[model samples]
Target: MEIRRLAGRVRTAIARADQKLVTFVQSHANLTTALVTAGLALWALSTHQSAIVLRMAAAGAVGYFLGLTPAVCVGALSVGFSVAISLEHGFSISNLIIEVIGAGCSAWLGYQHKMQKVRQEQAADPHAPQVLPWAVVNEIRTSLAAIRFLLFPLHDEEGSRENQALQQATQELSRLEALFREMEQRDRAGEGR
Candidate 1:
């Protein structure tokens, strides 16, 4: 009983810690990434070790995890740190050039990896809400409205039952389209919040 109680307490603590971490990450991802980058750079400088491959991999991973802009920033910071360290010792132009190229390339590679992952996820998630471009949505709506307008002329050219049915179907299409638009807007607003 005591062991179970202890285990429960541990689980609760772990859950709380995880929740806190999630909140911190979501709220201050950029700040956390920058802080971590600085810390890693400082560690490398202090160790007096040129961890080039490690730096490259880290930059790429950060890019993948954070995004393209942050990845680029990571590469920039890495280059900055490398320059500072080289200035302290005998400056090696060749090493600096390699580092510059490596950092830039790694960042781009990571961003590409991230984009691929996004595509894969979207492909896998069949039910995922697809957010179309606003302009495209507007264009489609305009086309539908124009079609409806053409179907519903001011002068009734054909008062046949088939014509009335077509008009009703178009009205139903318009209602459904408006509902879809309203739902999409709500979803977008919710995402922003």
Candidate 2:
């Protein structure tokens, strides 16, 4: 009975620790990535090993899912550290190129993965507004309104193909404006409810 009790206690402790780890990772992902990258760079610098370059690159790629800024910073640090170490050892151009290429590929892969995840989330919630912040959305709308005003004259210009295209564009813009208004009204109605 005592052994069973001890086992249960151990399991509970492990579960609690796991939860704490998850909470920490989620809340401080950017900081965590930065620290991890820094540690990897330091370790590579101390060991003066070329193989560690690959590990740093892998860390950078994985860091992408965390956040772009942190990942980029980490990638830059990794490359810089690798280069510094290489210069001290023998300054191999091929090694420097490889490190640079690895970092670039990691950054690109991470960006693509992040974008794909965002696209998937948007696709899953089609009714949701685009991922842009409200300020950016407002700016874009304002610019579009200006463009529409500029094109307004073209809409009435005599039977040229360009005028016809302009007319269609203006009509489409009106539809979009109506849609935005409707969306705003729906949002207000939702808030009231």
Q: Which of the numbered candidates is closest to the native, going by highest lDDT?
A: 1
Model 2 Cα lDDT, one tens digit per residue, 94-157: 6566555555555655665678688999899988553646875886587587657656653455
Give the lowest summed-lDDT range of ten residues in model 2. Answer: 32-41
Global CA lDDT computed for model 2: 0.67
Badly placed stretches (over 4 Å) of model 1 are 1-50, 129-193
C-alpha local distance difference test of each model: 0.73, 0.67
Model 2, C-alpha of 41: deviation from truth (Å): 17
Local accuracy of candidate 1 as per-residue lDDT tens digits, 18-100: 99999988777545544554554555466565586577777789978998788778878887887888798778776666666
Where does candidate 2 stray beyond 4 Å? 1-59, 128-193
What's the C-alpha lDDT at position 108 in model 2? 53
